[model samples]
Target: MTSTTDHTQQPREAEEAREGEGTTGTGPDAGSGAWDDGLIARRAAAASATAGGQPVVPLLPAPHTGTPASGPDGADDDLTARLDALRELTGLSRPRVDAATLAEAGRVLDDAAARRRLSRRHTVVALAGATGSGKSTLFNTLAGVTISDTGVRRPTTSAALACSWTDGAAGLLDRLEIPGRLRRRPVQGPDGPGPLDGLVLIDLPDHDSAAVEHRAQVDRVLAHVDAVIWVVDPEKYGDALLHERYLRPMAGHAEVTFVVLNQVDRLPEDAADQVLDDLRRLLDEDGIALGEHGEPGATVLALSALTGEGVGELRDCLGQLTSERRAAARRIGADLDAAAERLRPAYVPTGRVGLSEEAREEFADRLAEAVGAAAAGQTAERAWRRNAGRACGTPWLRLWRWYEARRTPGTAERPPGGTPGAEATAARQRVEQAVRVVADEAASGLPTPWADAVREAAARGADGLPEALDGLTAPEPAPARPPRPGWWPVAVLAQVSMTLLQVVGGIWLLGQVLGVFTPDLLPPVLLMVAGILGGPCVEYGSRLAARGPARRYGADAERALRDAAAGCGRARVLDPVAAELLRYREVREQYARVLDPVGGDGARGRAGGRHVRVTELSTTGR
Candidate 1:
């Protein structure tokens, strides 16, 4: 059966009156003056009604804003602004305070207020260990009362117990999530050495057991408590589950840890020391500090909770530690350090090569030359005319013209040299070859990836050039409108009549020459002159009829070539360079965001530097 005790101590009426009346002082009375202890206690009780009768707020006052009352509350305002700035920096939609930021806030709170609440200096030491480690006996011995059930039973201490110091250190109990409803008792010494000031000894349930909820409770309260005392007995000293699961994982918190070898009375005196030494060595190997052998690691003490041999020393040690107020800061600092490490990766720079302005300009220039926009347009005009002439006119017609220019009056055959159309065809081919050569040369020096992209873009741009040029150069097949019906036939009939007249005149002249007809025949010279003139007239009219189609074809071809050149320039050259430039801009923006100290929100001052206090709020509880 567990021993239970009731604490009947109550706040004195005179002390309560002093607490109700607010005063400007830096002592315990300050917490009392601003807040009614009874009211706070009642509120805590009401809040904890749903959670297994556990008070959420306990009797602790809210942490005070330790701001100074000078310079128009500048320090208080500054802290508020800084916190707001930090909030903006994180860009968090919810109140997601990291461990580091929480620690920083705690430090700020510590600096801004005086120690008016005795709880500020108090430490909550929880005894946590595996099952069958004799932790119940240790708890009872430490409390100087049989507060927990310790027997030969397989399991003990199902619920937690709170052993408080009589030095009015109830605030620490509240911070640790221990309620006033928990059984409390005072520890006594042979001379009744005054209570272990500001220490709350908590006897927690076995962490490894069938009662999983009991273990969860221990974990939930561990975050709020100051220090932890892990108890282990000789039989379970080298337990793999305990060391691997708890001791090794908490190696970073070497300062506030206390490892005790309990039930040492079961071992021989000489073997007890040896086993204790071995346990310390094992902890050291697992990265836990042990004694002063290394940097002040966790202190190892051999104790028999059953015999109560080391109970006084343990109590004295707990008192001294609680008085120093090291546990809260140490625990908070470790959490903060871990959080800071996690944030480091977010600021690291990713690799990217930077491009210079001169390089970009050079690339642009090369691309401009490759497309040959201006030159291609001019060359296309001449090439289109030559190709159109050969496609529309007959080779024999060209041959006849060449012969007409070279042959003397009575020549029977044409000259050996080819017609003008042949020379024009050759010239057209040369122009196309030149265009290809210039385009290739201009695209030669670009970076491979960009070069490929530009080439692909140019090819897509020029895809329609061939069809556009064909449409532009196609000859109009529709016949020209005849001069009104009657006039067009009359002109054709008149030409036929003239040709018949000439033929008749020629026949008559031949007859006159043979002396078979009268000597008054039409002159052959006149007939010949008429035929020659008529041939030139017909040729000129034909050329006049075809002029519109030829002009239209030439215009269309020129437009097509110009469009193709423009498309190639845009896709192959301009687009790739522009994309590269845009990529550089994106990279630059990302780097700027990482390096920008003020988070780019137009906030005041730099982000990282020595912190300056902005404001001091009234520490008096409202």
Candidate 2:
């Protein structure tokens, strides 16, 4: 390695020599202003000896940003609480989201918990970049020691190397899985204290490594770090893989990010400036923030680890950041935001879903038909009429009806409705169809899982309903035999009188024939005619009275069937479906709580310290 002093002094010597003489000398010191191999080696050696056991020189000064060092604060406590709440709430949403998504979020929560528990005192920051990006060199230079090996190997930084400026970070490093040998304590120069007092710096493997394990390692650690420094060299500054793969996806992590164009000393002064501007443009296109005039988005720095060009400026920025010590919270907050965004779809609004009246009524109608309720009701009406006729009609007619009832098939025997045949089959089909309709209706506005559950519930309800329906026999006294009217007895007496009148008429006629008359023959004949006519009128009145009871009987039977169908529908279909819907409602409400921003007064600012709100999901399930 060429020392900075030697390389810079060579150019100065040339300018002086050229000004002093018209001809330049071709020697080791002034040959085209390039240092010879011997001179470079000697300078390197002299520099090492000149250190005199002293620590590396400090160029960057502490920033005056007044950001506090990492310490216990109510804000962090509140943020942790909010994070716990978020994790718990997400668990409740397990039924709605896929297993993969839930597992991923669970990992995030677990990592956050572990990191928080390990050490909130040390802000873990990592330097990550593509191969040959000078990230390892920068890390070693930052620590002012050779902890991570640097070389021309394809991937020099194989494993993560950590450097901590403060104590109590050993536990944290162990958790990161960084071996103790690769860990180093930063040089605390004679300047009393450095700006990165409680900082823990890491050099991670190249992000786009050909080796899968290397890339996996990068991903694993990136999730746990408090902040990141993206080291990009001049040659690969505009690489889309860098921006598209890592930078763009981490848009929410801008506040805790630094985009440094490492090895900028390789380029000329003007070229370096152009590269910086162009890189910022690329980052902008990548949606990685470039804070307004370096306020606090992605702080861009142009630094050279070998020459220490912009290292001081980067140190100053990081110094301010470390002083504030909000990177851990900011990083964790950004992660939670990402998780919430990913979970957005499950909570999409669909409003409310339920069974419509028309659907329920249709379902009941189908079941009613399946069970032959209508036929049974009509049968009941006929049975009532027969019974009423027997109780209130003339004795001769009653005897004839009794004989007829005995001959009738299935009279108060099996199912009141004759049999389960074509009508029953058709009814069963209709019942199944009705179940589908009700299920579809109830599931209309619900999410996919809930809708399926409702349909299942409806099917279950239909399955057990057929037999229950067919077995419903109309309630007994299976007949509606009304009491005999008072007029019935009077009619009986009148009939007797009529019979007597007829007998008298016959006797008188006979007497007349025999030449002896007891009463007038005309009067006896008139009486007989009246008695016969009145008897028919009384019997007709009794028949009319029986009609009302018969109709009521039919109604009662139909009602009983309906009650049975409704009970089946509720137990099998409605109740189960309702339970599923209620579960959905409960989860939806939990998601609603998830949607609400954790309204802590000062415990948490917006993620990235930008005034941004998470997109709240509508409850309508659109």
Candidate 3:
């Protein structure tokens, strides 16, 4: 037979009973081994760690043979997978999620691990209610012993008092952070032997206590319990402080929750039923379902804690609950549900964020302009023409060479040599402008924080890009001269022919002047005129023929510089920004998968499509 009585409570109970037999010291028998209340209570509490022997103390014929320590593993495995996903998400979202939010969600995982390591043998049930609700009395009555103090003052319970049903749950209690002084064990009662074994009951201080510490203690202990029995009386049942502040918020925890109407003995049976019905309606409005596992209803029960009236029904319910021993899992499951719900806002958005192709091309053009690509192309075209003029222009005139050196202080004429530093500076300015353009485009339409990240990413390696581009442009080579035009030889020959005529005319004219025999003077003078006139036309035609090569050189230079600038922009800015975007998108997808419901099986405690800030602990405290 399985007995889950606490190992620590029996010895204390025996010691207290032993001391109570002695006469009171205040009645003139004080010196004759008489025991006072304070001394007995203290002595009972001071029992050694080993004073309580075995955990189980039989109270009746046990129907169950084995401890319920081994619970169903299917739910446990499923819940573990969910928790694993939750932990992973917590780590992944650190860049965006605040520290406090992570800390709050993080506690669910920590508590889950702690609960698993602690005793699975005992179900930690808490009796929580406002002051004057008779929760303490109910706790003592449930344990079949008067362990908690019942009072009429505003706040009777100052701290949590725990009564464990079994011996092996000491580790579990320790994990709960309950001090040993405040812990107790239940002594068996005489009414047909109450059947509550493997149950750890706690009476919590009033949540609305005026003393901050008392309320804080209650809040702290409330976070660690496996199940909660909200002990509300007739008056406080409809209290807004209890319903609105606590019950409504914990709707997802309906599985492990119980709404018990304490002090129902004061109300007639029909009246009690009506109040129970009203409480159920309120719970329904709060979104708490009515039932456990597949069972339905809020599991509402009415009993008078002080009179022991209708208390048997409460005991039987506890007996079955303790025997099942899956309350811990249910409690953790509810915690996971709430945690998942809180994280919905971060992952719920869909669609990828990226720069359009048109936007990219425009940005590249801006970068090219910033690097002086057009100016460089034009300079290349002019330089090509200058080289052509030097190589194939009329040798006799050489006017193109002379014109190239026509330098003035403020003119647009090219210097005999180009300045590298001045060109680099111009390119640098263009690069700066390009950076702003690309960053702004990439960040457009993004949320403020994401936009900032995009801009930062775009500018990540911006400093080195200009220098790289400058190095590329510095070695700019002149375009190959276009194959000389097909008519270039004819033009050159015509010029030579015209010059010969002039030479012939000059010799004849000189001879005539020197009184030597020569051609007729009229013919010589006409030949000179024609030769001079034709020379100008031939030179003009040659310049015209050079235009094709000049334009080609300009286009080639523009292409090269544009390619270099584009490469610079891609390497330094666009690639990094794209990477950041992809990262954000990937994280969003991972979050979606993590939060997605598993096979539509809501049984695993997933809260679909709910979002809320986790600034405060859930109404469940943890």
Global lDDT of model 2: 0.64
Quote the lDDT for 48 in model 2: 45
| lDDT by residue (tens digit), candidate 1, 444-523 | 44323333433454445444433333343334563343122223344345455556656777787788889987886446
Write model 2 residue lDDT over 1-622, tens digit each, in one string.
0011111111111111100001121111222323222322333343345365863221211211222232343343334333434544454445445677566456556655566556555788999999999888898888887777788997887888888888889877887888888888877888734788889998999998898899988987887788899999899988888876788788767777799999887899999999999998887776665665534566888889999998999888878777766676667556655665565455444655666677778777877776667877887778667555554455445567678888985665354443547666777787777778788888887766667766877777778676665566424452244545455566566556655766776776788777787645687577667655655565677578767867887999888877787787778788877766655554454343333333332233323221122232332432
lDDT score of residue 71 within candidate 3: 30
Give the TM-score of each candidate.
0.44, 0.70, 0.66
Provide the lDDT at 114 for model 2.
Answer: 60
- In candidate 3, which residue ranges exceed 4 Å CA deviation? 1-78, 92-98, 151-154, 181-197, 268-274, 277-281, 284-326, 340-352, 382-412, 415-452, 463-553, 582-590, 597-607, 610-622
lDDT of 3 by residue, 237-347 (tens): 988878776776666565566788999888988999999999888876666666645543346788899899878887887887777666776666567656655554444
How far is 621's C-alpha from truth in model 3 (Å)? 35
Clashing pairs in 2: 67-323, 348-621, 349-619, 349-620, 349-621, 349-622, 350-620, 350-621, 351-620
What lDDT score goes with residue 2 in model 1? Answer: 7
Error of 1 at 476 (Å): 32
